[model samples]
Target: MAASFTTSWRCAFLALLALFVSGAYGQLSPTFYASTCPNLTTIVRDAMVTALNPAVGGERRMGASLLRLHFHDCFVEGCDGSVLLDNVPANGSTPAFFGEKNAFGNINSVRGFEVIDTIKAAVEQACPGVVSCADILTLAARDGTFLLGGPTWAVPLGRRDSTTASMDLANRDLPPPFANLVTNPPDGSDLIARFQRKGLSATEMTVLSGAHTIGSAQCQNYRLRLYNENRIDFQFAQGLKANCPQNGPAGDTFLAPLDSTGSTFDNKYYTDLTGLRGLLHSDQVLYPQNNQTQAKIVLKYKGDNTAFFADFAAAMIKMGNLSPLTGTAGQIRTNCRLVNPA
Candidate 1:
């Protein structure tokens, strides 16, 4: 009788665990829209191609912007599309609410919303309220990365959009460019902690930082590193200083490529870190001589492009799966920018 009871208890425990795991991630499927919205990938890819075409009022850098938008969205509210909400003014009973767009790390920084709007419009034309903005953002990021020569991964779908947005959560959860720079030697503990809080490991944090390989940073984002930090390459600093002055807002908006090959997705980000040419203080801190583990991973990626691509794709998929709202939860917004009207 005792043995039978123990077996029954163990089986019940395992069954509950399986149910919880399925509820979290099993609902998402790669072919989720195969029957409902078959042309979803093509639509997103076409829009992305148009957006990345510089000849038609678009920019190649928009690929990086779109990818960054997805990253920012996922970090704040588990990839529920809250970051896309626009600020709403008080209308009688409805109180004023600021959104993630104007958050400290996002204001004037995250772009490609117009592109997302364009994609959302196209998707709506075909599927008509069947898809979620969260899924669109996820697919757009994957498409953008692949179009820009990065590894492509299978993005699980069926995510729902959040009707609400949170500026405070965005400001609090999104790691800033200077997060790892607060320490004397800049050990990267703070930045690691930030990613860890989001359920990412330190190695995953290092891998995701490789996304910096293709983006550009505003002068204001790296001004202190160019002028004050000793870890940066001297020539790199001098080159940047020509555009970013040491003491003013005048050159704040000036732009600098994050890596030598800024427009192409590759392992050059890790290579730059190996040479102390990483543009951001948070970036360079990953490969500091003191942090053997992170430095080793950086060096490994620097030499092995194949490994970098594989790990990056895996990390992206994991990040996309963060606390998604599926089943009947949340709503599919008609516009990526605003929640549907009640």
Candidate 2:
């Protein structure tokens, strides 16, 4: 009886181990479209270069927009491209609405859908009914970053788009900019929990937050930080306050760069925190006045740009892998804006 029990335990252990290995690697591959669409890379790159032409001022920010879109999509619904879905009439009685776009973290903030649409159109022209919108998003984000002088990584593909999207999940899951911020900011512990729930580590969270080096935030998102918080740089806070008054103004929609060097993707964001120049309370909490473990990690990246780039690339690939619908599951939506009809 003892021998039989030991054997059964070993069998269970082996089965668990096999499942883990398969789950990690069986679905995604760097060469997922090697035969189906060999020109996928060129098609995406050309669209990005066109969409992000420096001559066009607003389009230059598309790289960061794409990155944020990927993060928002992955966090809410495992990067299945559900965030890309447009809410249509449910059964001819319900009104049409938006999905993740209405989430607190995304409303009026997320952009770059046009760029994704452009890439999808080109890919479809090259190979119809083959490439997935989810895969295009993952690749375009990586290429977008690389185009703007950021790190590049192999984005494993074969991800499919979900037919259904959930505004409830988006609102519940996506981390708000104000999280862990209000009265004394929580230690990185609460912030870490938010990322861990999405399968990210604390170290990855810190590195990924560095993407803030490029984008701009609206006055509405950080006005409280400027007016209510005392930890900000005095002059910087004053400057922000000038643009964003306590009460709402018609120009409250104005923008401020998240980091001083808003166009460059670099370690300046970490350096900004070291000098108490973080833009959002969430940004400042990463390196608080008191010593914290997350602070130590941030300090390391502050001193090493190479390490930040390397870790960020790895983390992005990890993020892109979160519960993808590959193999026989989900569809390659011809239009990323709407679910392919049954």
- Compared with the true structure, all predictions reach lDDT values of 0.86, 0.81
What is the per-residue lDDT of model 1 for residues 268-308, given as tens digits with 9 covering 90 to 100?
99989889999998899899887787789899999988778
Best by lDDT: 1
Candidate 1 local lDDT, residue 259: 90
Cα TM-score per model: 0.91, 0.88
Query: 1-342, model 2: which lDDT tens digit per residue?
Result: 996886565445444543443358676777778899999988998888887786754376888899889888888778788888775656687667668877878878898988898889899999998998888988888887887788776677878888777888887777777766223455433677778778778788889899898888888878888878888899888888877888886447889898988877889899998888888878888887666777888899999887777777777777888888987888989999987877
Off by over 4 Å in 1: 1-24, 181-189
Q: Lowest summed-lDDT stretch of 10 residues in model 2?
A: 181-190
